[model samples]
Target: MNEHYDPGQRRLPSQDFLSEPARSIPIRYRPDVLVVGGGPAGIAAATAAARSGASVLICERNGYLGGALTMVTLGSICGLYAVSPEHITPVVRGIGAEIAERLHTYGGTSGPMRWLETASLPYDPNSFKLVADDLTAESGVELAFHCSAVAVTREDARVTGVIFEGVDGRWACMASSIIDCTGDGTVAALAGAGFEHDVPNGQAPTTMFRFGGVDVERARQISRPELHACLERAVASGLSLPRTAGGAFSNQPHSMHLNITRILRDGVPPNTLDTRELSAAEVEGRRQLRAYLQAFREFVPGYEGCFIADIGASIGVRESRRVMGDYRLTLDDVLHEGRFEDAIACSAWPVEEHGAGRGTRWVFLAPGTYYQIPLRTMLPEGIEGLLVAGRCASASHDAHASMRVAGVCFAMGEAAGVVAAQAASSGTSVRNVDFASVRADLLRRGAFLGEDRLTQPV
Candidate 1:
């Protein structure tokens, strides 16, 4: 009997199928550090590694850098400055502050916008991309745009290299150390790093929109309570509004960036890895955006003659897969303003949770205080030659909300890159790198931790 033929005599198809023989993948670059995802975190990582005299390679799925900052037009660098009504010192500095200063020099950023509890620096997306490119180039890091990290090459408990797919072909690049800055924790999860998934009641995804010809002064003058009342009236008047209390900020003259659209898919958590669910979320997010435009035109004062300048390239994802690392930052740590003996970064941003409700749920830290992001948060368990940064760093859902902002990501990425480069050059594991040494390096670079700062060895 033919193997392709059924015993009952039913017609059968040919059994032969094309398969490739085993072959070696051409090594594109052998760098001291390989950073995945050229967003804020990856850019910081690559730049830091290269500046540390290590050859670095950074890849991004998109054609440009500044992942959410550019692609999603996030506009603001939250958690960069401190969060006190008085004495707003900058909690985030070093490379993060350098980037912000560049943006300000280019007239692409606004001065510190102070709120009652926290403050942030708003910047232009185009300026962010250019600044990222210039900084990364100046650091002598090799950048591969429009390439995706599809797979990994690992040897017993260690990731050796990353396989990337591009328009040209597939190639593998070797590196002594790897940093997972894919925000969604894509690379770490693929490399068998354990992660927390599908967080219950996680923050919802948001779509940011730009409006042109708006009366910026008038829009800024509208208080939060007044805006919420308008949104409530719009919903009551049968507007297809998804949320009730988002607001707009002035990005440029006569232009306002609105972050008012919320998207929630039934049976699908906001941070789901399902492609179908993500697609639906995108579509519905855009739909909600159109409705928001209509509502603003009909209900708001300054938006009567406004028009949408642009929508984000993608929906802004808030919470996602957080790799389970050496330590999981908890909500208690954030609320109590926990201080770590091995603190690598600090965040003053409150826990801003956008959930299935009319508005956001905000939990505040004590005035003029912040919590420490320990070095252990970036060291994922059961994965060697790898470190997690950005929003994917180990944190409980609420803690993630507080520390997942761009400023904290930049600090963490720089720390990861510096440590990874050191470990690579010194023939050591990332986990073996001394936290006290890391603290000294960060302090020397002008990063703010607390008064009990680490001092160099005598």
Candidate 2:
């Protein structure tokens, strides 16, 4: 009577079907300063706020903590530091620096390079997820994985907490303050904040992938003209390129994150649902990826024997909803390398554009040039007790291109955390917090808070 053998037996019902009293697990709502996201920015913000002595809670919708890092296999952390003015400006400090440092110790990243405007170091995505979780947990920040923040609860103009949707079903959690690190500006928009990005149609999109057994050097040898020629021939011969957007061709070991496939879609307003018709985009992306690889084999020298490795679990969405704050950082500021009095973080990452659906445009900062990101950018306009980090921070389309890099976002997260902690300690909104004290504390904590090449204390 093999218990497993069941010709007459039926599989258990997918749902609870037992005719008996059912037990319930109490729904837990525990986050003093709830941060909605667990990516690099969210992790940095949550960890710093926890260190600042608040019971932090991080709601990461994904099963994993590292958002883009794990999902996209974003192997490198770009823009943490830069070689500007002949001296490296290590703007991404504090928890972000600690993470980068620890990863550097593990040989996950390399030192500053001249070719790339900012210093980018490789990282292990799996290990990064573990480290982020460990840091948050160690700091006593309760994290909810597989839990998405679907809606927000607001009081007047301030955000009070969030509504979560997950396996446990819908639940609510109240918080003293909230940080929108969702990259897409989830909390901000839900709280009725204005956001904008490139209009008409957002730049082409890209689906990143990495493969093994690649001839790194040989692949690098393929010229743009050669690629264009092959692509032209392929089109003429009935092969088609993907219609998705283009992004980065990030570095990898014996492989690379091919971000060449670009798709163009309209940039919808914030709070409203973003449905730009991407259901068929991924399928077309895969088809183009396979086709392009085949083309490279036939035409390029390095791709003779290369094959696919692994596609990203989710698409690497670079640009999205940006919070409308008191001060909207714009292109003119970037052009003049403006530094501000209330600057929270500084960045030298260039204005990186991916596709030309609207036509790719790049405006590079001169050597030794950098710009400041003010605290005003984090606080949504006409909103109190809320902050934004990551790609959702206040910036014009072109400015977002420069400041939305991972390194810069990490710095922004750190800034948000410190400000949130200070405000919490003094029982005030971030806008009313003592700027002098905040700046002093950030400087004391080794965060880069400088004005005119001078670091000042309160």
Candidate 3:
């Protein structure tokens, strides 16, 4: 089956449209589970499903894996640990822990580092790509790189397959169960599933970059407050900087990965789904890097000799479309440490919101406490044979600010994979899969869904 578009039929005086003749897309390899987006979530989903005795295929739009981690050059894996003044506790385990351990072996990461009421694992983006490749390959998950999911094949309300456009043109691949790990809810949206998109009011995006020739010792000594003060000085000196306080990490000597530039246009974040606006955002993000470099050189200590080592291939979009699911995770849930009977993942990450303002808003959870994410959050409402995971999972904006990080995504993906595999193998609806069995499988796989599950027998 082929989905067709005919925008040319609508005439507009200001625009010209052309329609290409419809053609059938070739059916590619069939798999029990198809995971889209190849990011943290897709990696775990495909790996778990394949290891769970189901044939799985993961399609990534980029040439490599590690979506935002590699492509956007994210310096660290957030949401893995809960932190307080006295101790840092691991809250995300299972595939997330496994990946962290693997990164350690590859010298890709320096393990968890505590900062301003939180803890994260600092990693090298390049090494992460290799780790993702080896992890998925060893798990027997087929990989198709440079493929973008363009359309969905649906039967009633169920997603039967996805059509992807790659370098070789379009092709379709059938799957018994599908997981939308696209981060933007692209797959679910294409399948006609309802979603919420509010870019102007959503969390602002960033363009991460790296600087070389930095005085690592001096830079490391600067506290978050000091850093902000320095940037503020730069701003007062007739320089423009959208954000004063942000993250800066060094996994390599004399180099720093900076996540500081907040991309906005006309006092609001540009709609990233629009090609022109997205392109402009990318350019603006890079443009801000120069101002940042000057600010660090003139106002901040230890960056006088710093030079741009790299800029992300694209801007890091923090939020886009949050697909409506069986449950919408709320800020109250995050703050109160909400628990669910069918919990599949746990997150301690705070509600870190980036807006049009120069400073971000952070509402931290109780020290060492985390909230459980139910399986229902991944089950898109009115959709069958599909699961939505990762940043695009059903969550209120404030709640998404907590769960959208890489660690929680890994946990969510792992559960979605296992559930999808079970449903695919049994020829059952995803919602019909027994929660107890799913929880048991997740536990058996060494996942931590919360302390409440510890008393239950696996």
Candidate 4:
């Protein structure tokens, strides 16, 4: 009767296995806190831990940071603000606000732009990468780029170290505490942690792309509904479009960043963990872009002269493996404004689900209200000495849709970093760390955790 039970159970394929001789991998850096993945969550976790006076090391598969913001080439930073008819107020602060301010200072963002019922900050991916580098460097967080976590070292229920394969070959890094910021829960899965991976009912992945030579004024005038209508027209004319309604933002002149083009295989979302399917998805994603370019040029008003400026290095996976943590956030929690005693972060982002259909499913929260994400959500259910943050944190599929955005990930990572640092320094299990102390630390850092009531417009 327990949902979290047998979280890792799945259908297995009958395939021959190979045995390799055991070889010892060379030990690398042993920091106080080892944060895996250099995306928004990893960046925040490493920086926060380092700032908390812990020696932190972050390993990234790509040479650059920014995760989805840079690698997937997302157009805008979502989940940072709470929306109402009269006001758009920030709900996620601390590291998230700092990153936004820094991005603006670098001329990387178009401030906050309101669209539909929400507001998001449009940013340039290159500037985002620079901002990430500056944040980690200033916090004294060491970085190891081009490293992919392949295995995890566990002492009973505790994850002690991680094995990674990089350009230099396989190496091991030990730590007092580990944070799994890899969006797909890579480290947790390898450590035999329970996780939920529902490919059949999972949100479909997208291939983000950008267009140049656009009439900015004309493009800006086209609202979401109008764009959908235009795409519908294209569809009626025998052009295939998996998703007609999606996000489009412009931070530069004569250019548009598009979050369009849903990628599916055989009418279903591809399982990204499978190498053969993942490779096929990448090729399929690019192939969809060509069709979209033609659709925009022929049907859309301002995109008649538009050409493909760039495509994301990878497909944007909205959902994958979600680790089973101490508590799984639910849809009721998001809609009913769930608060927690050990709350670490707040999110006002709506439940935005992309499925195997032309339109997405969006369920918005009440105006000017938000839900608190507790620190327990990041603590793996039966695992010690490890924290899983970002999209892969414990949550139901619906709750994950809302908290999976960049702003919430930043908040989660920041909290996890602080907790990890305390655990490592005090030689305590992450679950045993004092919640009140962690809450105070987060409050001192300017994080909004739904404790201070905001003035809502009547």
Best by lDDT: 4
Question: Candidates sorted by lDDT, descending order?
Answer: 4, 3, 1, 2
TM-score, cand. 4 vs. native:
0.96
TM-score for each candidate, following the candidate numbering: 0.93, 0.84, 0.95, 0.96
- Tell me how far the alpha carbon of residue 419 in candidate 4 is from the true structure, in angstroms, after superposition: 0.2
Q: Which pairs of residues collide in candidate 1?
A: none
* Per-residue lDDT of candidate 2, residues 1-458 (tens digit): 01111112243554634454644333367555778998878988888889889888889888878778878666467666645545665656777678877766556555444444444656667667777777888888887889887667778988887888888787887777789899888788778787774434344455667656667787665554455665566656776564222232434567655556655433331111234345555555566678767765665566667678788776667776777888888987776776888988877777877654423456777765678889899989888888898878988878887888777778888878888877777778878888888788777777775545532211
Order candidates by TM-score, high to low.
4, 3, 1, 2
In model 2, the number of clashes is 13
lDDT by residue (tens digit), candidate 1, 358-414: 688888888777788998899888888999999999998889989999988998899
- True-structure Cα RMSD, model 4: 2.5
Full-model lDDT for every candidate: 0.83, 0.70, 0.90, 0.90
Listed per candidate, the RMSD to the true structure in angstroms reads: 6.5, 9.4, 3.4, 2.5
Q: Largest TM-score belongs to which candidate? A: 4
Per-residue alpha-carbon lDDT of candidate 4 for residues 1-458, written as tens digits (9 for 90 to 100): 12232222444443544456899889989999999998889999999999999999999999999999999999789989888877888888899999999998999997688887888899999999999999999999999999899988989999999999999999999999999999999898888888898987898999899999999899999989999999999999999889899888999999999988998989999988777778899998898888899999999999999999998998899999989999999999999899999888889999999999999899999987889998889999899999999999999999999999998999999999999999999999888898888888988998888846675321
The list of candidate 2 runs beyond 4 A from truth reads 1-27, 84-89, 116-119, 197-199, 221-238, 242-253, 265-276, 451-458
